[model samples]
Target: MNKRGQFYLVATVIIVSIIAGLAVISNYSYEKTPSKFYPIEQELRIESAKVMDYGIANGKNTNDLMKNFSRDYSINSDSDSSYFVFGKEDNLTLAGYNELNSTTIQINVGLGEQAMNFTKGQFQAFNFSNTGENIKVIISNVSYDFKLNKGQNFYFVVSKNIDGEKYVATNL
Candidate 1:
């Protein structure tokens, strides 16, 4: 009877230890897992792209179009935030990140035949062209100037940067 009781006690201890170990492992994995912000980010990107498409197709004014679109929709959620900025630096770029998927997404809208190179720091530069229409856009407290011409061909350049957790989207 003593041996049987000891065996039962030992078995219970082993089961309890296994349960505790599993709980610890689960907690660790939950902490290490990335957030599920990619779906929301992708939705924002698609909405932004749709807004751009509609604005370009209908020949709407950049400022009014963006303002109206933004009024009806927002890219922010409880866990994430985003903003859309339209700029004319010989081309247009819509860039942001998907934290859940660990990817950086960039969508380029070109209004001219000539290709343009844009760097991260170039977001601060505002050079207005003399010939095309110059317009100002504000998103998340950042302002940009876009020069565009009517009847110009538009191009799209889509790119993705992986491992995007290091990049945080700032309100400004």
Candidate 2:
């Protein structure tokens, strides 16, 4: 081929390569931002049963356990008076007064969507027996931006309580 033709060919090749490189680089940069990312599975909701179980299992003191419950469930009940449990519907609400602490009611419920909606309501108070079954509770609150769906994005916090004692929170 002639020299001029060879020069033009080389120039054309270089131009094409530069354009391809620019495209790849732009895509790489766009993907690096956190707003572009998304999680695989749906973010799970904190179940009432898990919270009760955590409270029963890990709580160190009554106050501590109730604190965990209050924060996790956004409850306003006094620490010593809060109770949470899951069981039959018959013996759900039982209020008894104690001199050491305020009068506390005990209610046992299910661990499903209905219970979750109920707990998320205005009744931030809890009532459970301080006796046989030690209940533990785990709760997760997830919120996201405009683009991502509620469960699709991954900005969330988890709070777990056991026996009104050990409580822990984590971000995932």
Candidate 3:
């Protein structure tokens, strides 16, 4: 039989169940890791250009900017990114690779016979002269080619890993 207060009791139970489900969901989310890195890579690309410009205007070189940005990002973001920033006109090359960690990823930056590899959180510049040639990059076994424009043209390759998935972005 339907009682006057019975409906109110059923409604209250339904509301409480919904709220409890939401609470469980919220708690579960905080324990899981993401499976993608493109989102982080995109945000870095947008903000990094501004910072790079500021650094260049202040007479800072690409190598310096790359090191500083990598350091700053490691300090500010939960995710880690490996980066290679270089100008085509700059006759400098420094390349090193370290094992990946929670704060490190891998990227190979190359021009002709000159190749530089970087691990996240490690900043070392290698200097080599370019004889009017172009450079290409390989990420996750995929090769990409791009033209290098004239005069102080700086490029960046940022790579990150999440849940065994790797994502990379470039400002070319």
Candidate 4:
């Protein structure tokens, strides 16, 4: 009887110790893994693309389009302390970083047969057009010249880079 009791006690102790060890290991692993919080960069990219699409579809002039876009989407560059660069070549690219998330997004808007393509990481693309001449619009101190012509195909690509983490925007 005494030997059996001792054997059961030893078994219980070993089982408990193993469970505790596993718990500690799991906790350590959880702490080591970084949590994916809100994707602020992706949100900004999507909104920026939406603004561009809206402007292109509505036939709003450059100034009005920019004004409406800025008004609708309130992105305080001063408060965020971020710089957005809008470049226009064969395509229009909007690139900026948000200090809060430490993430950067580059959105490219191409016209007529996908002028600009992103080969770096995953991205979401959108295409829209209007029947007019090319117009230049300034948003947040960045100028974007959109070639809006009749039956022109405008492609918008949103790509995000966060600490070497890659993700695709579901809503393009």
Candidate 5:
């Protein structure tokens, strides 16, 4: 090979080696487990209401369960002491396909105090996938109970409305 050709071949080989090394490192460090928080029983109990819904709706309820959730969970701007849950569920079934859509569940809990505001604010990122649709629900800030020296527990719920039929509540 000519001088220029030899230099070009060497450069190409070096570039390929660097790229291959980076690819191997990236694949090795890839995360297999998802990131999440599984609260202790103490903390989980405080948010039992929300937790119950998740268990029941997914047919995980071995115990007798009777809980009602509104389609939308909302709170008043002035006072967060009280909140409202409202929404509609729609179902679509044809042939062997089935889907449910829940629309508009709002949550406004607590007084929106500094701590509550921060805690509840994280609810914006809470979401679920249902029947090929993405449903968003806001958990109220008031749903949390805090204790000194102990980690706080917060509860929240969301639902979506499909075209017409009622969708079952699944997760909180």
Candidate 6:
């Protein structure tokens, strides 16, 4: 083959390789997954359940358990901000705030018939008690409902914003 023909063929191959590399890099730049924090969330659920079991065996109150679990989980996970909603008996506690990916994503928190809506990055920790009724929580168009009993029952929710969408991991 002539030198000129060989040079042109090599240049075309190089150009194609560059374009393919750029395409692959762009796709890998941002990835969105519904279960962004699945592993961490599963760990949260298991640990919380164990805490509850220990508290029950020792006849400890939910308030103490909630406080310790919240603090320890926040530190150990080293994750973004997250709010917690959990309690037993007539008490339901909602604490901490979860960071949002965008300012337009809707956030809602509910307990029983009362529901509070907050804008993105506008969430605040709040607490209230129930009157032997069902507890309801609505977050980013998703709804979670639970019925509390006399036993050491608790519910924990963790949400992470992934590409402007809310992905939640919960122990229900």
Task: Tell me the lDDT of candidate 4.
Answer: 0.40
Per-residue CA lDDT of model 4 for 97-167, tens digit only, reads 23334333323333332232222222212223332245443322344455544331232222234457533
Off by over 4 Å in 6: 1-36, 75-81, 100-112, 115-125
lDDT against the true structure, per candidate, is 0.42, 0.33, 0.54, 0.40, 0.29, 0.62
Indicate which candidate wins on TM-score: 6
Q: Candidate 4: list runs displaced more than 4 Å.
A: 1-27, 31-38, 63-80, 87-172
TM-score of 6: 0.58
Q: In model 3, which runs have C-alpha deviations exceeding 4 angstroms?
A: 1-36, 59-63, 74-81, 92-111, 114-121, 131-133
Tell me the lDDT of model 3 at 44: 68
Instruction: Give the least accurate 10-residue stretch of model 3, judged by summed lDDT.
Output: 102-111
Model 1: worst 10 consecutive residues (lDDT sum):
121-130
> After best superposition, candidate 6 residue 107: deviation in angstroms?
12
Estimate, for each residue in 17-110, the C-alpha lDDT of model 5 and write its tens digit. Answer: 9999999988885533211222222333344455455655686631222112211122211112212121111221110001121222332222
Model 2: residues >4 Å from true position, as ranges?
29-61, 64-123, 130-172
The clash count for each model shown is 0, 34, 7, 0, 21, 0
Rank the models by lDDT, top first: 6, 3, 1, 4, 2, 5
Q: What TM-score do all the candidates reach, one by one?
A: 0.37, 0.33, 0.51, 0.34, 0.21, 0.58
Residue 142 in candidate 1, Cα distance off native in Å? 13
Q: Give the local distance difference test score of model 5.
A: 0.29
Model 5 residue runs over 4 Å out of place are 29-34, 40-42, 45-172
Model 5, position 10: C-alpha lDDT score? 96
Clashes of 1: 0
Per-residue lDDT tens digits for candidate 6, residues 74-99, read 54553555556677645666655444
